[model samples]
Target: MNYSRRHLLQGSLAAGGSLAAFGDQHLAEELERKLRGRRPLGIVFCVSDGMSQGVLSMSEAFSQQVRSQGTVWWNLMSSQKAVMGLMDTASSSSLVTDSAAASSAWSGGQRIPNGKINVDEQGREIESLGETLEKSHLRLGLVSSATITHATPAAFAATVPNRGQEESIAEQYLNRVDVLLGGGSRFFDPKVRKDHQNLFEIFEKQNYQVIRTRNELLHSKSEKLLGTFSPGYLPYELDRKHDEELMKKIPSLAEMTEAALSRFLSSGDPFLMQMEGARIDHAAHQNDIGAILHEQLAFDDAVAKVLTLTAHREDILVILTSDHGNANPGLNGTGSSYRETNRSFSKVAEITRSTENFLSQCQQELRHSKLDLAEFFTSTYGFAPSANELDALMERLSGREVVEWSQQHKNSVGLLGQIVGNVTGVGWTGICHTADPTQLTSTGPGANQFAGLIRNDSVRDRLLRLLPI
Candidate 1:
């Protein structure tokens, strides 16, 4: 049904609408044309934020260490069904696009500005692919390592003037989505919300299987699952790999993606699930090689999981792409030096883990009610400090640590010095997005339309045209 048909069906047509009322004839025509000969039961749009070319190459190489066969996504890229494109990730304001515009283009079929969701230049509202597909009577799923409100995932479901409108985005959960997972628990907490809308309670009341712990996530068999694994962004793969505690407590992206597919496939038809590896961008921003490589591997594992489940499904389409490029990650080769690093790195990945593994146990002691700051620090970061260090940390942390450190100049200097001491010179250009052409690869039926170096908007335009909701 078109806009007018929808309104007329509800017996309340809005003013200034030009669409004609829905007719059974038109409905039959749509079905015959799109759904008759073809059987695209579902689509999964997976986007990695700010993945540079070097990032992709290195990630594949990194995964090769795990299986020696290399990254599944890269191998799938060579298939005939796959289409290649250079996504011009420019937003309305710059050559480089932020997560909002880059993702909105894919989610809404319209190019928007940086930091805006489904809004146009004139501040008008636009329905995202998530909302559109929801209206089509299809189950909707959004999975990301970041909070669901983080720009890319929000681009398809929430319409807001600013990308930072996370609290309101959490309210959209009441739309009764089939499956939703990721971080950003602060937005759902009643005490954290200024408007007194405790979304966690709302979700619980809605009978959604709300899961906050890894064990809960592992055991959940509910029809609908809402998992917020962290208060903020989940730890990078580097952190998770290094930290044994985190690895066991928090499931990998692969597990989350596979769980979503299982829940979606149980619904008897194809569903829309978009999976994002959010922390890859954060790792790039921090210029942490260990973090970047591990996170990309996590994303690759998720991609591999999807392919394993959907590879034989003629009705399932998978579009994998990145929003923009960050830090232009590259391995400065000294001939075999790069190769040597990978060999050593693979061994290191097995032995070393993320810092978060050790920190999770510390969270209970660090909770607001307990408030043992010094002990918390001592246990988490391995810095059993004197009174002077404790005093400084108090001054820096203020009363509550709802917000994490920004990794800024002086802070970065001190923190890095304390944790992995005595570093200098290297710093993030800015805590912002960078402009660069991204990569897009698609597979499954009608995936040919996504080929041959297209624009970012073409990703959506093709999908909408090929499968207009």
Candidate 2:
């Protein structure tokens, strides 16, 4: 239970080392004793899809500044209640792993190529954790801020050659998954799917209560539930909080976690639930610092809710991790150091929308007549750049410079990220996924199994070892 960073790093260097080799026999015995009880054991995996160490640090700092308390994840580390480790997130094909392969590593315990979901290079489908657990009579659930059919969630529930086969993924959810919550109504709607199959109707006929709004999800009492709040991915946490319609329609990540937990608890059967803050990856991909901070914080809130639910229960195991690092963001040092960095980041609270959404709105508004770029930035982002900054942005908008810059950066989103970074001290390395090792924290039963450094696929190995076969 008491592990120093040096000890963890030393253990990490030994590729063949495992939880038993770590010499935590007492903890393992304790977990075994707890598992021997009559109540079935439950497992929950919480993933912030693209969070890095820098992202965790910044989000914890921002949470403390705004709420006078550190995030639940940081508090867990500070309290040493969670066993922490590093996970190398690489696919068989590349060092940098996409969400599909990253999650597949955890789901199938295999090193598949990037862009695959629980499917190996041989074109064979591997049994995902969800399918395996469901076969063991364990209730299964998948929740995400992104669509349920998105790569992260789909990697757990469905096995496909490509992550893009979302329609097939949605169909797979019908009998396999007990609880499914998130967006991607388009994949299920007859109007949007190329095959024109009404998956929702099929789900309804299967006795699943399909809910589309926040209120419906909250009131649903069905044993099998499907909630889709958006046609595509849900809005960013910052945008959802600022928009009245979104606040009403879309459930927060914590809300979805709570709902999923409610259903799983009601079943009285052992369960495996994977909850993902999928938009953390999207925001990081866009290099939107404010969006990333809020999304990570939202994920932390869900972690807190799970901790609350599992407070006194030793039968539950909680694993919190990220699939991979995106955009490698950090709070760059400034003249005033900590004070200036805090001051600059405090401005993120004023941001109500993502740069992508704001730009879309701007394009819609500009179709009528000429628009003042300076005023628009001021109103939308809560800070107006100087006249020169406005002129430069305007020139980029007018010429091919935007396209050229995007080739080097992350398109227009990268340009906006640079502007925001100038005001805030946050900086991004690039707009692509990094091969950096991500953090993993685990508590409750089998927590020691996840300690120290391991490959991403080993996470699945440890979880399977903890499950009662």
Task: Report the number of the highest-TM-score candidate.
Answer: 2
Q: What is candidate 1's TM-score against the reference?
A: 0.75
Judged by whole-model lDDT over C-alpha atoms, candidate 1 comes out at 0.69
Candidate with the greatest lDDT versus the true structure = 2
TM-scores for all candidates?
A: 0.75, 0.90
Estimate, for each residue in 1-469, the C-alpha lDDT of model 2 and write its tens digit.
Answer: 3322223323333323455534566654444444344223778999999898899998888998888889999889877678888888999899999999999998898899999899899888888987887777777899998989999999887989989999999999887898899999999999999999999999999999999999999899898998999999999988888889999999999999999987776566788899999998899888898789999999999999999988877788898989999989998865654667767878877787887687777676667666677888988778988776666666655544643334547356777788888888788888889999999888887677677888998776566655664
Screening candidate 2 with a backbone cut-off below 3 angstroms (N, C-alpha, C), the clashing residue pairs are none
Residue 320 error, candidate 1, Å: 0.9
In candidate 2 the C-alpha lDDT for residue 236 amounts to 92
Off by over 4 Å in 1: 1-36, 335-432
Off by over 4 Å in 2: 1-40, 336-339, 402-407
Please, what are the lDDT tens digits per residue for candidate 1 over residues 1-469?
6642332332211212223533456644553344334435778888787788877887777667665768867888776667776777777767878888888888787788788988989999877876876777677888999987799888878889899999988887566367888888888888887787878878877878888878888899887888988888887776776668988877788898988887776676657788999988876665554566678888988998998898666778888988888866555432254455544334323323343343344344456556676766554434465675566545544433322354442343233223322111122433345676778888886565566666777565455544535
